[model samples]
Target chain A: LAKTTQPISMDSYEGQEVNITCSHNNIATNDYITWYQQFPSQGPRFIIQGYKTKVTNEVASLFIPADRKSSTLSLPRVSLSDTAVYYCLVGAGRGSNDYKLSFGAGTTVTVRA
Target chain B: EAGVAQSPRYKIIEKRQSVAFWCNPISGHATLYWYQQILGQGPKLLIQFQNNGVVDDSQLPKDRFSAERLKGVDSTLKIQPAKLEDSAVYLCASSEPQGGGGNTIYFGEGSWLTVV
Candidate 1:
């Protein structure tokens, strides 16, 4: 499993864009980068995933460079409800027999009104 | 489209006592996972099951913890002689294994355990 490093917490204002970067220098070749959003007393929800380059969904976008050593989760037009802990996970393959996705401390995003 | 369901949203017990948690995955989900989440940290995988069979139990403490998935549907996890360190949330997640393909995982609200 690749260990990820992210900021403990970050603050942003409503309607502004927020980018959370994760460093996984030891990420495996087959590993895929995934981001999840978790609110208090709830489970983590998938936001976006990427192997390389950029992948975007209705909720968020993931940008990974050629090296695949790092990835960034970009949330556009954040709202107060966006306040949650964002996790960056690297897995060999999700939902597979070899899957046992590990998580780090995660980045806590505080969206101010 | 019902998500994963876990029973007993919260539990309180004394050290060395026993406790059990139940989970029902989404319809037709073949893969199930159990995780332990401690305060101020992320979830750690404890076990993974596929269709009533154990796929992985490398991290599970077999000495005191056990889990079973019967008929490839609902499952239960039991911890006998629990310790204070076991005071954490137990989460259940499920997914349809797609032959190493990427699929979003759905998780239950989790069973919070407080072992004093």
Candidate 2:
């Protein structure tokens, strides 16, 4: 499993953009970068995933540099409802039998109204 | 599209007692996982099962914790002689068989356990 490091907490106001970066210097070639959002008393929800470059969805965008050592999650027009813990996970492969997706402490984003 | 289902949403037991949690994964999901989440910490994987076979369980405390996925659909995690430190949320998750790119794992609401 590739270890990931991210900020412990971040603060943002409504209509502002929030960016959280995760460092996975030891990420493997077969690994993919994935992010999840977890609200209190609920399960973590998939936000976005990418192997390289950039990928965007209805929820957020993932930006991975060419080195692949780190990745960033960008959220646009934040609202109070977006306040939650964001987890960055590495080491998920394509069709590989090994399923050891590990999570770190996660970055807690507090969106203020 | 039913998502993962877990029962006994909340449980409280005395130390040295026994408790169990049940989980039913989404339809057609071949992989099931059990995770323990402590307050103010990230969830830790306890076990993973592929269909009806065990895939990974290195983090599981075999002396008192055990989980089984029977018929490749539903699973049960049991803890015997629970200790005070066992107070945490037990989460059940499932994902489809990895085919290409990345597989997305889905989680349930989790079962909260308090060992007094």
lDDT by residue (A7-103, candidate 2, tens digit) is 9999999999999999999999989899999999887888998999999999898999999999999999999999999999996668666666798
- Per-residue CA lDDT of candidate 1, range B1-116, in tens? 89999988999999999999999999998889999999889998999998899988999999999999999999999999999999999999997745555656789999999999
Give the worst 10-residue stretch by lDDT in candidate 1 chain A: A91-100
Best by DockQ: 2
- DockQ (C-alpha based) per candidate is 0.62, 0.74
Per-candidate Cα RMSD to the true structure, in Å, reads 1.6, 0.9
Error of 2 at B7 (Å): 0.7
Q: Among all windows of ten consecutive residues in candidate 1 chain B, which has the lowest summed lDDT?
A: B96-105
TM-score of each: 0.94, 0.98
- The most accurate candidate by lDDT is 2
iRMS of every model, one decimal? 2.5, 1.4
TM-score of structure candidate 2: 0.98
Clashing pairs in 2: none
